[model samples]
Target: MAVLKKQLEDMRGIRYDIASLKGSISNLKTPTARQFVSPRQMMTNGKTPTKRSTPNPIGVGPSCISRKKPVRGNDPRKSAARTKARRRILQGKQISEDMMAALQMEDLKQLCSMHNVRYRGMPQARVALRKIPGLIVSDTEDLPNRSATGEEVQGANMEDAQSVESESEEEDDDSSEEAEYFEGPEASKDVQPSAH
Candidate 1:
């Protein structure tokens, strides 16, 4: 009878365990009033809920390429510098050496970009600025000096032509006089010696 009683107790325990197991299984099938993390979200290695590592690595890793994002436009600061440089170019103003020296190398590069100047790498700003003025002067040698305008050049040319024409007329008069001197014998030949 004791053995039967012990068996009954074991059976009751087993029944209790089965009931608990059934309850847990049912709860797993459909969790009640719980936050749902989708399968895609769970696949993202969910260690930190707030912070995630960015795809852009620190510095340039081996696999990484250019850091400048294509989506965003050019750096505004550089574009501003380029606009300033372009304005100066359109005005035909010389870039002052003092300003060139004061500006950063990047700013000078922006200036060069405005004028379509290309370089292998970052060149010396001062040297490039100095070269620009000389280039302007050399290329524009055909243009008359600032003091000599179109009217002044026309006046000078007119005066030169007048002087040349006057000089030529004077030479022709002198040549006519010399011809008279050489024609003395001819003039005598034309006159009869005497009406003998």
Candidate 2:
């Protein structure tokens, strides 16, 4: 019975020593410190964020927005002239042969319809041409010198005719002076006519 008691005491001492050793080992252990990062290290390690570049919108800057004036289309004067021509044709006034040649087929049709004129064959074309005033024949091979009736006539060149008319006026003045001088002397000579 005394040996059994001694064995129990030895077992108890062994267990107590084991428990103390475990507690000392736990106290020696320390928590590892957290790692700190520097700016240079962060950039090198691809951890830093970067900003992205963007494109500007159109018509924003002075170079793009402050431009010169925009381009223009056809002249208004030309359109007004065309409109006036159309109105005259619609009023049943005869269009000149020259003007008729200048107009397109569509214009002719419009003019005829507006004036309520019946457009017949080619023969009526001549009749229509004679009715319009202010129309001069254009100098084109297709349009020969002809009256409204399509009769071939020797039409004088407008420029040449004007020059000739001015010259004729000067000649008429010279002839009138000559006539007065010859008539004054010839009146006395006729009264004494007997030296035959």
Candidate 3:
């Protein structure tokens, strides 16, 4: 009789499980409806997804993806330094040799660039600094040692042309002297009494 009661209790437990399962099935969404929702939406329970403002993010959409980082022309710190140097120049305090000597090569370059002074091929920073003053004071557009006066350029070109001509003439004279030396000796030797 105890065994029979135990079997009845087991049967009741199985029946209760079946009823709970039916209730859960009724509350659950269909697979087709679940298929319509994105995995993100499903994970979020149909809530709006949050956006991250970082350059790289979890979701890689077309709009969010970038092949390369955006490039900035000038760094803020460098620009600030340039502005400070400019202000110092305006005050007529930083143009002194001692003040310029105190500045680093990079600082001098920034100063040159700020004033649009051409200093690309300058060998020394002091040389570049010297150009900045002429650029500021002179009304002329050209930088010192960059473009010469028209007459100066023409004179230089004429000098170069004359030197080349002189070099060519010297080479011609040397070649003629060598020809005479070689041919004269050979002809004299050939004219020697031929053994009959």
Candidate 4:
């Protein structure tokens, strides 16, 4: 009789658990009035949203900005130094020891650009700046001094171009001469003897 009574208590406990599970399932399927919240109120937190002047499809705000180019312009002091160097060249004057000593690495680079000298990978130091004048002098060696009418400058340009062409032609001739000297043996054609 006691065993049957314990089984009855166990069955009652299981039924109570099943009843609680069904109540929770019904509550989930049909939400209560307190669970229903308007989306506008939830998003804005019960406050009115601000209006936008334009539609931002990309979502990039105006506050996030960037510059495409450098803020600094070509340094005026560097330009003045280059002008001085050009004047010296026009006067048929050499880059003096005093002038060379005064210029910085940046000034040397500016001067190099003005004279069309390839300054890439060149050392950026006071001592290295000394070699730049030799390159400039070599480039402008054949150039004439400045004239009243500026015709000498134009003439100098033409002469420079002609000299460049002659150098290239000389190089081409040297290559052809090398090819002649290094000529390979010609292959002999294999002819079949007459079948007759």
Best by lDDT: 4
Off by over 4 Å in 4: 1-70, 95-121, 124-196
lDDT tens digits, residue span 41-71, model 4? 4444665455568766796778757676644
Q: How big is the positional error of residue 77 in model 2, measured in Å on the Cα after superposition?
A: 13
lDDT of each: 0.57, 0.58, 0.57, 0.59
Residue pairs whose backbone atoms clash in candidate 3: none
TM-score of each: 0.22, 0.30, 0.21, 0.21
lDDT of 1 by residue, 51-91 (tens): 56668767856664758556575656655655654555556
For residues 48-161, could you state the per-residue lDDT of candidate 3 as single tens digits?
A: 577667675767676756586656865555556556555666654334343454455676676667666665543564576576543332222221122334432211245555
- For model 4, what is the alpha-carbon lDDT of residue 129? 47
The list of candidate 3 runs beyond 4 A from truth reads 1-87, 90-94, 120-123, 134-196
Q: After superposition, how far is residue 183 of candidate 2 from its true place, in Å?
A: 4.7
User: Order the candidates by TM-score, highest first — what do you get?
Assistant: 2, 1, 3, 4
For residue 82, model 1's alpha carbon misses the true position, in angstroms, by 14
Would you list the clashing residue pairs of candidate 1?
A: none
Best by TM-score: 2
lDDT of 4: 0.59
lDDT of 2: 0.58
Candidate 3: RMSD to truth: 26.0
Candidates in descending lDDT order: 4, 2, 3, 1
